[model samples]
Target: MDIQVTKIGMVSCSGEELPEGTISRIACRKVLTDLKPNETVTICLPLFIAGGEEERKFAKKYPTITVDGCEKLCAAKSTEMFSGKPSKSLVVPDILKKHNLSAPKKLRHFGDEDQAAIQAVADEIAKSVKEVLEND
Candidate 1:
């Protein structure tokens, strides 16, 4: 049988909306869509308090991809703590730097810069997922 793969997003906080154009959420969605139908993706926001146990069980049965929005590494850290090892990790800042992009100063609100950043990160994640699936 093929290994089940799960894509998970771990954000720092749960209440605030992501800056406009930030691709973190969208990139996450794209990654989920790109996965094989048998695969699963879970977006574990900070507010999610009840499903950790179920998620933990599901994670053990699949390859999990964790995407972190900033240097804080919230998502990656959480996944490691919960699931042991994330199959892949996509860090937003690293993606931005890879594309020579800079975050805006007033990123407290969503905007064009935020969108670009999200897209860059999303694109990288989508590509990574494709490669993994293909190789498997």
Candidate 2:
């Protein structure tokens, strides 16, 4: 027998101004595509905020995690405003600080040093996915 579970939605902030935003998006893609493909669905921030009914409905029905690039918490705040509260809110900068990793300064293009931040954030997102699934 196989038991299937509902996938968690990951809402990543679409901030392009800061490197952390780039990190946030990259980390989320890593988690969604490689780390937790079976456990997560990507919710486009632009669409979610632009009144995407499907996105909003998915958030309301399933457990969602918002990954924000900075302290502004754009993804988290927008999620709460449009849909409901997210199960977890992962901040890239905070995660970096917690893991003692420095935020990558490069924008569009990243260097070898940036990989640590990406991996760390991806790991955090994957970890959050597990916790939310377990608690669900």
lDDT of each: 0.57, 0.90
Which residue pairs show collisions in model 1?
A: 19-110, 20-110, 21-114, 21-115, 22-114, 22-115, 23-118
- Residue-level lDDT tens digits of model 2 in 33-75: 8999888989999988999988888888889899998899999
User: For every model shown, what is its TM-score relative to the native structure?
Assistant: 0.68, 0.95
Model 1 Cα RMSD, 1 decimal: 4.6
Off by over 4 Å in 1: 1-23, 33-40, 47-51
Per-model tally of clashing residue pairs: 7, 0
Model 2, TM vs. native? 0.95
The CA root-mean-square deviation of candidate 2, after full C-alpha superposition on the true structure, stands at: 2.9
Point to the candidate with the largest TM-score. Answer: 2
Total clashes for model 2 = 0
Q: Model 1: per-residue lDDT, tens digit, 1-136? A: 2233443332322213333224465666655565333444555655333456666665555556666666665666666776666667777667778888876555365576466766677677767666655665
